[model samples]
Target: MTSRAVPPATAAVPVQDASLGAAVRLVRVSKTFPIAEGRALTAVDAVDLELAPGSLTALVGPSGSGKSTLLHLVGAIERADSGSLTVDGLDLVTANRRALTGYRRGVGFVFQRFHLLPALTALDNVLAPVLPDRRPGFDRVERARELFDAVGLAGREAALPSRLSGGQQQRVAIARALINRPRLLLADEPTGNLDSRTGRDVLDLLLDLRTRHPMTVVLSTHDPAIADMADHKVTLLDGRLASSSAPSAD
Candidate 1:
């Protein structure tokens, strides 16, 4: 395992023409979890949201405000108990398990903790998504190297998670999320584990990557300053939407 020096910032390459990204629509979506003693707890309650394609939306709320649950519903990790949940015209609630599994592959998820396999090198970690089932016409290794370069780990391909700093680990995680070229990226508290400066750097990296990848990014965060950077803002309270702001014109 090796480490690489941070390269100087370079001009962003020309935006590649790719999929227009996925539009997310939720109509009265509700999700509940079974609790002990024959009881249930509502994680999301009749939440309605419309996220534009290729836009960045911030999910703002405190802990247990349904942010994570809402992301899970969109990612198809969890099903909605009632109401419609659709992404790019596919009905998530009615989709079968197989279909949902396929759907999950196309959607990328980033977590607060950098969930890298400590044993695998950075490049190998990025390649994990495609290892199970290779996609036709996709050069897995080539793509992995390209992503390493894109994420500023160009020379650190063999570096292990234990060798990288927090920021670098998160960058690797971001690269992993983009391995499939997903049209939608779901991030839950992406910056929560890093210090303020590093968190901002990670957030900026996400924004920059969105421009190049043409993907709609939805991230949940507790920091108001971080939320302010998004194109659109959605605030949740007690499993319900408290307010949703229109995308800023700027």
Candidate 2:
């Protein structure tokens, strides 16, 4: 599908007995794809990472450095070829279909391209994720409205993607990602398409959402300035880890 589809919601919404974030860990993870002539291209080399609950980590690297692949592995869009990965104590690498489904429902993803449906309004786009199963008490529409408001798009719910500016469209995308109350958010260069000022605004929105929801966030970026804002910074080179640093008190 060109547009992102919501994962099946067979699992119940996670209870807030604790915080909204989930711990993620990776040990010697790697992924490779077969190319022409039967040779393989390693997208992610054996790498280890650990993300504490409710923390923000920035993945910084150049193009083709495996930043996106790392996020994809954690989001379960792509599987690791070897090693282990766990999120919130669930073994992702060996998770059964049902368990993986449940895990996906608790995670949200945003990309450089605001994958909003051109035909759908902002509110409709936000509500798209919950459309598959409209159980009672879900309040899908109400939650979408609230998210739009939360992202500063309250009065623009009826606006179409074509009618909204780049930043506004990105805001709608952010609202859509939050509709499921995901505990882990994966973003791949979410601000890459925006101007500097607007990118900063979108970055601020993401940081603000982190504080409001206390969810673990991992975003890939090429901008050092943006990476500096994160609580942790991880750099990749040639599908391998170059450096990992704690958050700086700037």
Candidate 3:
């Protein structure tokens, strides 16, 4: 029998407990894309890895190293070509479209570009993700306000993206990512567009948020300094696992 479909964003957002982090497991997973002349480029080669709940992992590599692809795979934006991929026991590789949509709702995503709505206020941007979802018990507005405070943008809620600095915009993006109280958060070069100081500040805020709301965070970055801040570091090269500082899964 098929598993119960996870409620969409229109459903009530569940209040996650402190142990809400999702555990991730991958075994020989691979993803490839077609290229010119009927050729294919392997983005994620056969690889195996595991991330413990509530742990922060850094996917460190140069450009074209598959770090972003791995993040995409985990975020359910791309499907794997072979092998098994599971997060919180949900088999991502094999999940149906509806299931994947529900899974996407549960997984928060932060991007390097800080994908905020140009016309919306910061508070509205944070609330955009769940605006369609009607959850009687949940107060999305209050939660957005709390997140603004958590990200050090409490008073700037009325500001538009154009009025905010890059750092502030990124902060708003971070807050939006957490609107669903996701158990797994994926960040693809989240600090890449900021100045050094602002980047550091964003990273600090992310780590702080992780502590307050327990979740597995997997971020991709080429900067060694950024990778150093993670609990475990995995390096990818030519779509393959080149090295890993993470311990073996028990």
Off by over 4 Å in 1: 1-18, 131-137
Worst 10 residues of 1 by lDDT: 11-20
| lDDT per residue (tens digit) for residues 1-250 in model 1 | 8999987698554342337688889999999999999999999999999887888899998899999999999999899999999898889999999999889999999999989999999998998987465568778888888888887789998999999999999999999999998999999999999998888899999988877888999999988889999989999998999999987544
lDDT of 3 by residue, 82-141 (tens): 999998788999999999999999989999999999999999999998956576778888
Provide the RMSD of all predictions against the true structure, rounded to 1 decimal: 10.5, 11.7, 10.4
Residues 1-250 of candidate 2: C-alpha lDDT, one tens digit per residue:
4988888978654333338598889999999999999999999999999887887899998899999999999999888999899898887888888888888888899989999999988898888877476586777777888888889988899989999999999899988888999999999999999998888889899999888887999999887788888899999998999999965535
Q: Which residue pairs overlap in candidate 1's backbone?
A: none
Q: How many clashes would you count in candidate 1?
A: 0
TM-score to native of every candidate shown = 0.90, 0.89, 0.90
Worst 10 residues of 2 by lDDT: 11-20
Clashing residue pairs in candidate 3 (N, C-alpha, C atoms within 3 angstroms): 10-133
Residue 182 local lDDT, model 3: 96
Q: Which regions in candidate 3 have their CA more than 4 angstroms from the true location?
A: 1-20, 247-250
